[model samples]
Target: MESTMTGNASGKKKEIHVGLCGAGIGGVFAAIAIARAGAKVTVLEAADHLGEIGAGIQMTPNVARLLRKYGVDKVIGDNLVRFEELNLRRKDGTPVGYTQTSRIEGALDQPWWLVHRHHLHQGLVTVARQHGCNLMIGSRVVEIDYLESNEVTVRTEAGETHVFDLLIGSDGINSVVRRTLFPAVKPRPPTTNCAYRAIVPYEQIRHDPIASTLIQKLTMEVWMSEKAYIISYPISAGTDFNMVLSHHRPHPVSTVEDISMADLRAEYATFDPRIQRIVDMIPNAQRWPLLVTGPLPSWSSPRGNVVLMGDAAHSMTNHMAQGAATSMEDGAFLSVVLREVLAARIALPDAIRLYERERMPKAFRKQQVSFLNGAIWQLPEGEAQRARDRAMEPELRGEPLLRSPNLYGDPATVLEVYGYDAEAHAERALQEWYNGQDWRKDEGTGIEAPVAEKVMNWFLPEKEKFVSKI
Candidate 1:
């Protein structure tokens, strides 16, 4: 296969062709960013349609600023609900502490938005297409072959073969690209937590004396309790309310299954009466067990050309509400790094290395933070639980909440997570990597090394057995 380089109107740099394995949020966002950076991108989606499931996503300022830069925020303008605060409360409806979204926006220079997943997905699709991204639906990537020419050939289930300079695995947790890269690693097992999700029309609850209060104002509410937590907020311009209830269970069930309202109510029987009333208003709901994977030793393939992002790289629970936000950040970071590679300012291997080096640590950190947040939310009834409640009491009294620092820090640290700019981070990493380093030699060698040898050398210095397989 021969490499092809197309020039833009200004004829500044060669356009890099990027093959994306999934057309979900991350893939589509990456497509837009790459196209905006003057590259050609094609997204392969397995589904026949380009839409997201029934759910709501919280977009922090970090993600919002990137979306604005990509023009996605304009496409989704006013169709989203902006919240002033995130209200935390106990299961009994006692107010804990609150994070002022307004304050965060003032600090970050962008608003916090809650939007329907479908709305966000549709907006991204629109903006990506506007940037001339080729979105091929019903095309599932079945296999990927890294060629000796420093190119990649992707074979879809439809038997069509396409070659590109880079291949990205943005296909969520069950990513085919991820499986192909690490066949020894098994599918992630289901976590002990199961979630019930539903969307109720605002009109349905607007007239109810108790339920109407939930919709009278716009705020993201979280109710924490022993072994369970509930999150509810308005989405789709407050025409509907999206709610998710997660609880610990003894055994794992199917990821998604039809669940009865009675079952949901029984599970949250100990919750506040107001919460129960809201649960009763759910016309339909589905339960799914959360699934997670062990952090991969590396997100990139041994060859370094093929890599993972978003949930494909690090699947975490929703406790932090950063699932979609972090995926957007991944796309932003990858696009910036690839722009440097395509411009010939950096070698592909070094670029990929820098991308992984900057992203892996942060992604893993967020994953651990998300896990810890979930644990805090679901602490069982005990002395530990009482202490947590006591710590939250100050917040209830409108005082600055004092939290005992542990493995994970305070809410301020979470605010820092929201303040991160992925694009800036990637650019800085690139600068640092090129500061007196001779990356040109690796570039001259076509960036090819034995996959097994590289993995063994990097991960297990003493293990020479894996090198024999290469």
Candidate 2:
């Protein structure tokens, strides 16, 4: 294998030697982005087979644009469902929060899609290969050492050590690279929450006429309760419906090893009959314990040549369905920063610092939203949950006091999340940095930690009635 970019050097085109630690969605997209910027990319994966573990996953417009920007959007769009609307309802089936899917695409000029995790994974792998990335499966990076020269040497389980100018860890939340960098960062305990997921054939869905129609629609519908939240969407050309039922209770069997239909039914026994009926058809359901992590002390190694991405850097709750979307966004923004660094001839450490400085604040803001969503959805119904729901109803109905800038804001609401243009910011930041300016630290002018908190509280206010009711 060629070890350096000089082996196949052509005139004029700048070449970067990049090594990626995981071949998952984030890793593959990073490869695509770096390759588009004229880099020689190599990906290493621990899994012998290149299949994802989950059932279906959602990709919002933010992720959609990243894939489109990297030329992999068509692969995802060709095999996924484009949700036209997103409906949030109470357990009793009363509508709560509503938003047109058009707003997402309109804000970002890209569409949202839902696909099987395996399908999207395969699509990303295909795109990565087409873009000239060398994907080496079953070669897990067992250790990483940042040399004095600002290069990285990664040692794999197969007893191979590869040195590269830069190393990226996209190895999910259980990142080997992250653990090596910071052994003290323990995985957060199960948020007292777990989800049971399965995909049932669309034909079987028709058995329940009312739900079957809803299941076939081009919408992502979620029903919220203090006990749990139910999310269902159409995937596989409406031939199947993806379902995830989450709750805030411990299970008799926490491991995915022994999960069966009976175990699933017992966990979901208190849900609506409609949801229970759907779970009954699923002979086997996978159990996934939810986890949380705080902002890292540092997202990049002290060497600056090593950095984390995706779940390794920040793993948020799935309440907002932003985990995968945010990972893709990370890849997009990280790529732009790397390109800027290269153009400006910035040192590797400074570039990594710049990337983390620009990415962390936005990622943290989303993480806060995800945490609040989990709290609201998992609150047990009593006087507290009931009063909390009542407070949210007004906000859902367009109360002026509750209206502000958020991920779900309507027209006239500034697009902070979806409307962001990382490519543009990156280009400007690069030009400024090259001209000996410190634009990285000042990327988000007037956007501070307190400002983000205040903005978030506008949509989600503290419910004194909830505390008093309890």
Candidate 3:
């Protein structure tokens, strides 16, 4: 109901408040970035506590650079395993594709890092608090009353309601904000591919002869077959090994964290014996389906006061290892474009539009690429599999490639995808889009649309329909 100007070091700009749902890495980092850009951001998290979480994640150079920029690299320094090598192989260690992590650093100027999900999340939360971002732990956003008049009220499970100029839904694949706002639409159809994830102590493998050789401190090895694969890397300062066994199933599964090792072994029966041995060392595993979100026609609400972020925007599979990276990019890009709102160069809606136009295409591209790579990985042992193997020939032989089936082995992709600078990319796109734009803003307070457009929007009975459609 109230809008005013706030004077800061940058200049006198519109005082804006954002209600952010979900405090995962993406949400928290977005808070930090937005607060640094001089906005007031409140993060509503469902979890009561974000403690020493488990599992490991591969951080590509692109995201690794961002983490470093925020000093997160220093915070999670001791917990990282700088990847020295990446191997794509059959269960028996036959090479499907391989690359030295040095190549990533040599071309992208940043190291490939493997870290515990908790460490990364912790690092983001630390920086976010430092940036004056407010955190509401245990406050699950159950109702997002986003209206056509640019009014958004977020109600949590605890019955407290808060209003903000904007709402960002980084609430993850099963986002409450998304469900509350766009109740009819679904993220994706159920997925068939699921995975069993477990962490075994490094000492367990160290005592076993075969399993010990299968793992190394600075290596990530992925073992695959026609239908199943296993990804293993060290995490938590190399004290444990993170193992993910991807398997295909005929029916959908309800995800459970503590699945019996018997079920895991039975499912992965056809996988490499080495993988089986590694599975034997695991006491428990979690069966998590590789869920994906259908790409929204637009990542913003029709009014633009409310929007989606991270997996809330574009959830995908694990093939590209870019889910976190791309989500973080979403935050960094938002920080840049939203600054235009704070500076009065663009209204909030236009800023979101610009952010969507510039960022969504790339995010969608990553989604498709991730799905494609998963398909390539699951090809049965036949001509298709051979074709995939041949696709790796150029990179394996130390030669140049023109769009290899193996996305990771492509040098051009390595450069373009890994070396991407989010702020630079958004700035360039916005500059071009802003220059050609026809609308004007009243010093960022509001957009000055023609009378007809305003009247039409005012008359529309179902504005949420437009937002959902868009």
Candidate 1 lDDT (Cα, 0 to 1): 0.76
What lDDT does the true structure give each of the candidates?
0.76, 0.70, 0.77
Better of 2 and 3 by lDDT: 3
The TM-score values for the models, in the order shown, are 0.87, 0.83, 0.87
Off-target runs (Cα >4 Å) in candidate 2 are: 1-14, 251-257, 387-414, 431-470
lDDT of 2 by residue, 187-223 (tens): 5634567777788887887878655656656777677
How far residue 98's Cα lies from its native spot in candidate 1, in Å, is: 2.0
Better of 1 and 2 by lDDT: 1
lDDT of 1 at 215: 63
All-Cα superposition RMSD per candidate: 10.1, 8.8, 10.0
Q: With candidate 1 superimposed using the best TM-score fit, by how many Å does residue 81's alpha carbon deviate from the native?
A: 1.1
Query: Of 1 and 2, which scores higher on TM-score?
Result: 1
- For model 1 the local lDDT of residue 411 reads 48
lDDT ranking from best candidate downward: 3, 1, 2
What does candidate 2 score in Cα RMSD to the true structure?
Answer: 8.8
